[model samples]
Target: MPSSQTRPTPAPLLKPGETVVLFDGVCKLCNGWARFLIRHDHQRRVRLAAVQSPEGQALLAWAGLPVDQFDTMAVIRDRQYWERSDAFFEVIGQLSARWQPLRLLRIVPRRLRDWAYDRIALNRYRLFGKYDTCLLPNPDHEQRFLKITMPFVAKSEN
Candidate 1:
């Protein structure tokens, strides 16, 4: 339950066995993906972070990713980093039936698969639009979200 506000930003470096997903929090499609994972991730196997958040930036830097490129999803798994299609596939592999079918696309050549992924990512905002701000987690699932003060967590009456 570490809050981004209180923790000093660590110099960017990858951590072993930790799976951190960095995403564009304000993107409607991205938020929907996170929510879907939250509901289906029965074991709570992944950690979430908004690409715009401090912790997200730290992670990106540590993983040696470009700060300006937050358009694609990034997954840091087993101390190794994956971006674009690889990251998306890795995520789906960990989720339930809701996303499991995406794993089948892995059989396609990496370049082609990534090309499709990039097209969708590039047009995500145009197709799905975006939130004025990051989506807040549902109270019951708040514990699954990475806490960042700037976006302001929505209070859950529960």
Candidate 2:
């Protein structure tokens, strides 16, 4: 396989030290997870992106993932892609110390963890629910998402 650094196209850009989470915007379970991340990531270390969005598509392409057949959520940072259960841990790793305990889940063998994750991901829409259209992010958290077109708000240059 060709190295990521040698890919013809440039890697998707992200803010320094920021990890971008790409998920299915229409899946209720996924939307809920996004809300949970928004609520707990106090330092705003994570950014959200819907797999259907331009930014997410670019990242997926860069990661050599199938943008059209997206089945699992992913976390990307510093040109690295973390998928399935690993993606979950990647985001958890960026959270506060309170989340440190969750790391113990790693003790459960990655293959098993990934198998469990696959079951949910494959049936996410059926098990949870899905929207006909992608739900837009709430105004309060719009800034944390990529490809969102929130209403214009002037900022003081001070």
Candidate 3:
């Protein structure tokens, strides 16, 4: 994870009332989390974006985060952005009432929580593998995804 001193000064990625989640497009674990959110977020108040997409890159640029290294999930609410463990808690806290209990994990210190998060993140691809291409949302959930002109594509086989 990027240090606070190196992290970007956030720029607005969504409208004042919108909340967007930026995740690694090909990370299997991240995709699972996205699916989890879809199932549990009864209010459907959040939108999703792949960190490698154009919009994601632009937002990262504006937020002063490195576009090349996506080590943490981000939750962008209104004009604010939270990454690492804070991002997880922020999103879970707003989820369905039954899911809100996940927020209790915040009782853990930020450093310890982020350390665990980073460990899993570092091994995510090795442990869970990666998708050949970015995952597209189902038609019913299309509106919940931020469209990017340039989507990630898997390299062609020779």
Candidate 4:
């Protein structure tokens, strides 16, 4: 199998037709963002997974991102994976007309946009506190979360 460092496409991670939002499970801010997505996404266009979960780990492996270091939000749509502010814009832009305007942030240089995103991400736990456990989706929304068998673990040498 390809290693997590290889940068995989998003399509294979989804079912026949679906998208996913992979987020930091312990971060309150990220949970808030996921809640925003759940509320605003009327069409149920995307599913959510916590980066600490097995499903999230699998997707991270497929995307070639380290499962141990989830410093950015990830949105997987239309067979592509977007990270950081790009992921933020892409998810919101597709939600509704009201959110479309947020896409304008894309005009900013990626390096600049990501730098700001990184700062907030780095301090999110300090600013917002953390959940002792991953946030649980509402009972009605449980199906929208992806489930996995187990996380992929690399071999270690003694």
Candidate 5:
């Protein structure tokens, strides 16, 4: 059996109105997506957390999701949890115009969309080079991430 230590720690209690996005920290593609969101989200409405983080684990448990199945992106919006393609679309909907157009993907059936997402997720490590560790956020974006056991932010030049 996988040790409980391998499982993520429970997340901290979040205030209402916080939308947390949990992702695979070591996945290069996932890290890129987080940076993309941070860049496009001019309003700074979204908060990011890694699936391996305590806060992320807590949120996954609260949402009744299996922590081991976090290979793909997960979005917690309005207190509701979304995974795979559904999570992707919902996140785009919250972004600015260029990203909002992605919301049209909702027209695709959930099963079909998630099937495609799963395929990419399965091959992500092979297709997109993974990191030895998660990407640390730059200082300017530090406020965007919730601190976890590992340092998730890089030092600022300032």
Candidate 6:
């Protein structure tokens, strides 16, 4: 098995043919973002997972991200990991055209963009408060969450 520290392109982590959003489960702001996604994503183009969950841990480890400190959110699709602001733009750009204009934020320098994102993200819990537990999908949106049907195995380092 490859060391969790190295990026592992394990497509099996995905429940097949879906874009996944990896987020901070307890962060009210992140939960708000996830709900926003659920509401506007009429196409149902993405599934959400909290970074503290097993599924999120597997995806983050596969992407060589820190599983302990989820200071950033990411997107996984087509066996690729899109992190930080890149992940933000990737999902919004795929949403309805009204949200498409948000993608223009991409033209800003990545350093500046990520810096702003980091400030808000790092302070999310303080600014918005946190949930005692992760968000649970409502009965109607339960299917929009990702669940591990089978155990995820990491690759050994060569």
Show the colliding residue pairs in model 3. 8-63, 8-64
Whole-structure CA lDDT of model 2 = 0.84
For model 5, residues 1-158, the per-residue Cα lDDT tens digits are 10011223333455555667898988889999899889989998788998887778877787777887767777775446677887787677678887766677777887888899999998998999788986778899988987545656988997
Selected candidate, larger lDDT, 1 vs 2: 2
Error of 3 at 29 (Å): 0.6
Off by over 4 Å in 2: 1-10, 148-158
lDDT by residue for model 6 over 42-121, one digit each (tens)? 99999999999999988877777899998998888756668788889888866999998888777888888889999998
Model 4 per-residue lDDT tens digits across residues 94-156: 697988887777788888988999999989999998999998889987887877546889999
Cα lDDT of model 2 by residue, 49-157, tens digit = 9998888898888888898997999887775778898888888888999997887887888889999999999999899999998888989899999763458899999
**Number of backbone collisions per candidate:** 2, 0, 2, 1, 2, 6
TM-score per candidate: 0.77, 0.85, 0.84, 0.83, 0.80, 0.86
Winner by lDDT: 2
Better of 5 and 6 by TM-score: 6
Candidate 3, residue 77: Cα displacement in angstroms equals 1.9
TM-score of 3: 0.84
| RMSD each, Å | 8.8, 5.9, 7.5, 7.6, 8.8, 7.6
Which has the better TM-score: candidate 3, or candidate 6?
6
Candidate 1 clashes between residue pairs 3 or more apart in a chain or in different chains: 12-62, 13-62
Worst 10 residues of 6 by lDDT: 1-10
lDDT of each: 0.74, 0.84, 0.80, 0.80, 0.76, 0.83
* Model 4 C-alpha lDDT versus the unseen true structure: 0.80
Q: List, residue by residue over 1-158, the lDDT tens digit for candidate 1.
A: 11121123333432445567889989999998888778778877787888888778877777777776777888765546678888877777677677777678778887887899889999999999989987777788777755544666899998
Candidate 3 C-alpha lDDT tens digits along 54-103: 88897777677789998989877655678888888878776878876777
